[model samples]
Target: MDAYWSPLCTACEGLESGSVLVTPVSERPFEIEATRDDRIVVKFRDSGEERPLHREQFSVLVDRLEGSPITLETLAPGVEPYAAVLSLGPEFVSDGEALSLALDEAVGGESPHLLTPEEARTRPERVHDDAVLLADLLDRVDADDPSSLDTGTLTDLYVLLSDVQRGADRVRGTARNSLLERLGPDQQLHGRFGTVRRTTRERRYSKDDEIIFDALDEHDVPREWVLGVDPEKLDVVLAVTDLDEDDVYDVDEQVYVQKTGVDEGEKFSRLQGLAERLEEVEGGEAIQEDLLEIERRIDEALASG
Candidate 1:
C-alpha cells in the first residue's frame, strides 16, 4: 500500500484545517492547504511555500528533499528567526497585499542566505535547541547522582549520553563549518564567549581487494578477520550469486529506534580539540550597537584576539 498518501483523503476529510503530516525523523513539517477534488495542497512548514501534490507525487518530492539534504542543526523548530522565516512565528515578508516567503531550499554548505525581513524584528529569539537537550540530560544525571559503579541501569545512561554527545557534535560541526568558511581553515576565530581554531587531519582508507589482500598476506594477518570480503562487494555478490545466501553469509535483522541525521565524526573531534585549546579571555560582551559600531567592535575583538 502507498505510505504518506494512503490516509491523505481520509485525514483531510477528518480535520477542520486540512491534513497535516510531518516526517518521522526530522519532524520536517508538511501540511495540506485545502482539499480540491482529486488534488491535495501540500508543503513543508519551513518551506514557506505550498505545492499541489497529486496523491502519487510523494516519492518525487521525497527524492528532491533527500537529494538536497540540510544539516540537522538548521532545522530546530520554534526558534526565533528560523521560526519566522518558516512562517511558524508571527509574520513573513509582504509585497504590500500578500505575504512572501523564502522559496530557496536550506541545504548544502555554508553559503549566505538572503536576509529575510522577519530576521530584523525577530533576532532576539535565537537560542540553540541543544541547550535544552543538554539541560534535560544534566537534570537526569543530577536526579540520580549516579557514579560509574552505582548506577541503576547503565543502558539508558549510555544511550542518553551518546545522544547528547552526537547532538553537541552536530551543533559544533555546523558552527565550525560556518566559521571556517569566513575565517581561514588554518586560523582561529574569536567569538564573544570562545575562540575556535581549525586544523586539518588526514584519514586514509582503501577498498581494492588486491592491495588489501597483498598487505594482509605480507603482514601474515588473518584475512578472515574481515570476513575475507568487503561488505560492499559482498552485497553485490549476494545480489547475483547462485549459491545459498545463508551458506555465504549470516544475516541478522534487528529493529531499533534511532535519531536520524548527518553527524560528521571527524569534524566533531576537531571541534572538541578546538574547545580544549580555548583560553579564557577576560572582557565583557560587546554591547548592542549600530552597524558601524558593531563592525568596529568586531575589528577590535579580532585585534585583541
Candidate 2:
C-alpha cells in the first residue's frame, strides 16, 4: 500500500556504457552508468541505496508495466543515458504500479530484452528495399533534369533511400513509381515536366567536303561525326570547326560538347522523339549510352581518326 516502495522497484541494467533504465516509480526513466570498478549504476530520484541492483529485479519492474509509457531521468553525473518515461494508460495504471512493487521485492531473475549497440545497428532487409526505391527516384529525377539535380537534393534523396533501405519498406513502392513517371516521355515525345533526352549520330569526313556524310552509311548526312582510322572503327566523336573556313581541327573532347549547346539540345530533342517511336520496345533493353564509355570511345576515335 506504500505510495513509494523500493521493495518492488526493479533496476534496469544496461551496458556499463550509458543506457536507459526503466523504473516502476511514476513512469520516470533513469540511465545506467558504470562505476570505475566496472559495476553498473542506475540513478533514480527516489531515496534508497545507490548500490547496483540485480538484473532480475530490473526485469520484473519492466514486465509489470507491459506496454505502458515511463519517464526516464538521470540523477547523477556520468550516468547520462537516453531514458524515456513510458506513460501507462488509465487501464494499466493500477496493474503497472502493482507489478512495479512486485518487481522491487523479487530476488534474481532473467534480464528483460535489451539491445546492445551492435545489435541495434543490425541492417534489416527493409533498408535495402528503401535503397532500391531511392535509386529509382533519382533515376526518375535524372531523366527529367540531369543538369538540374543539385548535390543537396541528391543528398536528401540519398538519405531517404538509405533510411528505406535500412528499415522503411512502405515508402519504397511510391518512390519507385514517382521515379518511373518522371523518367518516361509525355505524349509529345518530349519529356514530361520539361525533361528532354538527347540523341546523336556520327558521320565521317575525309577533307573539306560539301556536306559531311555518314561514311558508315555512305548516304545520309549524320547529325554528328566521329573520326576513326577505318570505317569499321568509326567511333563517335564531337567535331567543332571554324564556321568561316572548312579547316578540321582537333579539339579537346570535353570542349567539343558544351554543357549547354544548340547541337546537344537538338540531339536530346531528337532522343525524346526516338523514345516515343520505341514505346513498344520491351525488356528495358535499348540503345543506351555508357556516358563514361562514350567519352572514352570518342577520345579513342579522335586520336585514331
Candidate 3:
C-alpha cells in the first residue's frame, strides 16, 4: 500500500486538496482521497481509472465489531451513496482495495467476513455482551485490522476509559479512608496535603488549609508540626495534637488527623522529617520560602508566639 499528496480530481470539478492512501482489497489496489468538502474520490491504483462518487452514491458500512471482530457490512446501492467506516480502533479503509489489504494483513492472515449490502446496518442491542464487544475491538487491533473503526469512535473509547479509571480511583480512596478510621487513635501515618492548582505559576494551598495553618500559628504550634499533619477532610484536620503542648482542646469537636508526624525525634530530627514530608506534597517546593528560610521562619514564628 502507498499514500501521497495529490490534487488530481479530473472526474470532479472545484474539489479541494486532500491526502490519499492506496491499498488492495482483493484483486487490485485503489487510490482513495478526501476532498475539501469531506467527500471521497476513488481511482484504480494501477490503471489510473477514476470514479468520483456522488454524496449519496456510496455504501454505508455498519461496524458490528462487537460480535464479529473481523466482519463488516456494505449497504446496498441506493440505500446510501457514500462509504464510511464507523466505530473504534483504526483509520477508515477507503475502498475495497484497502479492505482486502487489511484482511490480508489481519492477525491470522485471513480474510475478513464481508457481509451483504442488505445486512450492513446491525442493531446495537443485537451486539454481543459488553465484554465480548471490547474483546473484539482489542483482538482486531492486535491483528492489525484497523479498517473497522473511525476517528470519532476511537476518541469516544479513550474518553470512556479515562472516566472509568477516575471513578475507580475515587472508589478505592473511599474504601481506604474507611479502613484508616479504624486504625486506632494514636497512629501517625505519614501523608501529604492536597493541592489548589496544578500549574506551577498558579499553585497554592486551599483556603481551608490556609486557615488551618493560620490557626496553628495563632495557637503557637511549631511550624514542623503544622506542616506534617494530614486529615481526610479540611473541617476535621485542625484539632490539637500532643505535639502542640499548649494544652489546647476542642470542647465540642476534636480535630481528626488521619496521619501525623512521629514524636520519637529531636528538634532537628523533627524539622528534617517535616521538610522531607513537605517535599512529598504536591507543590511542596513552591509552597513556602526556601528550606533554610523556612527553618529560620519556624524559629521566628515560635519565638514571636
Candidate 4:
C-alpha cells in the first residue's frame, strides 16, 4: 500500500512548510521545501530534485480524502498526493501516512464489507443508543473531575468521540447539501429536527489599503487605533525606543498536555477485565503475581493520564 495525503488534513492541524513525506511502496521520502502563495515545492530526499505543484491541483485533493484516502495512482489517472501530504502538518504527517495507507489499502479492496440487511437496519440504532449512554456518562462526569477517570477509559472516550465526530460530519455534510438543493436564496425550512435558512452572507473589505487609510485619516480616525501593530514593526519600535514590554503588552503563557500515541484497546479491555476479576475475588488477598501485574497496569495508566 502507498501512503497518501490530502489538503483536508490541514483542517485538522496547522500546517507549514518543511514537513516530511514518505512514499510507502518505494520507501522513498520527500521533504516539503516551501509552501508559497501560488504553489508548493517538495524535494526528493536523496536526489535533491524539487517538484512544484500549483494550488489548483490541491483543490482537487481537498475534497477527495473524506471520500477516499488516495495516492496519485488511485486518486486519478494523473494527480497529486505527495503534494497534498503537506496539509497533514509536521506533527501528524507520520500518523496521516499510516492512516492514509490503511485507507488506500481498503480503497484498493482489502477486507471490504457489504452490510447485511439486518446490519444496515440495526447499526444506526445501536450507535444512537450508545450515544445516549455516552451522553449519560458525560453528564455525570461533568459534575466531577474528568481527570479522575483512568487513562485507558479516557483514551477510549477520545477514540469513540473522534469516530462519532467524523461520522457525524460526513452524514451532516451530505444531508446539508441535499437540503440546499430544495431551498432557494433567503428561503427557510422549519422541520422537527431543526430549522435551516439559506441566505447570502455579504462582507465588505478594502481593496486599496492606502486609500482606505486615507479615508480613515479624513474621518479623523487614528490609523494606529484602526489597525493592529504588526509584530515585526513592533519589534523595530521596541529596539529603537527600549520600551518596556510589560507596559505595552500583557504576557500570558500556559502549560498543557497533549496526546502523543494510543495503546491497543483490546489490551486495555483485558486489563479492565482482570481488574474486575480481582475486585470480585472471594478472599481478601489475591495471587502476588496477579496483584503486581494489576498494580503495574494502574501505574502505566496514570503515567499517561
Q: TM-scores, in order shown? A: 0.32, 0.18, 0.18, 0.34
Each prediction's number of clashing residue pairs = 0, 30, 8, 0
What is the per-residue lDDT of model 3 for residues 1-305, given as tens digits with 9 covering 90 to 100? Answer: 01111221222233222222222222233334434343455665457777665432222232332223322234343222232212111222334322322233223212122222222212321121221223323434432533556765564344333333344345445645765665555544443422122112466765677788888889999768746434344334334333442333445767842322312223224334555766898877664334434333432332233
After superposition, candidate 1 runs with Cα above 4 Å error:
1-8, 13-29, 36-39, 53-134, 140-144, 148-154, 185-187, 202-305
Our tally of clashes for model 3 stands at 8
Give the candidate number with the greatest TM-score: 4
Model 4: per-residue Cα lDDT over 9-82, one tens digit each: 33213332233454544534565566665566767656888887666666555445545555433333124334
* Cα TM-score of candidate 3: 0.18
Error of 1 at 24 (Å): 15
All candidates: CA RMSD (Å): 18.5, 25.1, 28.2, 19.2
- Per-residue error (Å), model 4, residue 303: 35
Candidate 4 Cα outliers beyond 4 Å, as residue runs: 1-148, 190-192, 199-206, 214-228, 235-244, 253-305
Q: Name the lDDT value of residue 4 in candidate 2.
A: 23
Per-residue C-alpha lDDT of model 2 across residues 1-305, encoded as one tens digit per residue: 12222322223222433333444333333444433232235465344335564434434445644554342232223211211211111121222223222233332222222333322222433343233334444445763564577875655454543354334433434644665555544322343223233333699756544434434457664545654555232322312332422233454545432222123233334434544544655632342332223333432332233
Residue 92 local lDDT, model 1: 22
| C-alpha RMSD of candidate 3 | 28.2
Identify the runs in model 2 with alpha carbons over 4 angstroms from their true place.
1-16, 35-40, 44-97, 100-305
Candidate 1 per-residue C-alpha lDDT over 1-305 given as tens digits, one digit per residue, 9 for 90 to 100? 14434343454445434224443234555555665554566566567677664534434433433445333234434321222122221112322122223244232111122222222111111122222222333444553545642343444444444554554455456766777788875777776756767677899987797888888999999888755566788778878887568887778999975644423343234333433433333321221123225334433443343
Cα deviation of 214, candidate 1, in Å: 17
Per-residue lDDT of 253 in model 3: 61
What lDDT would each prediction earn against the true structure? 0.43, 0.37, 0.36, 0.49
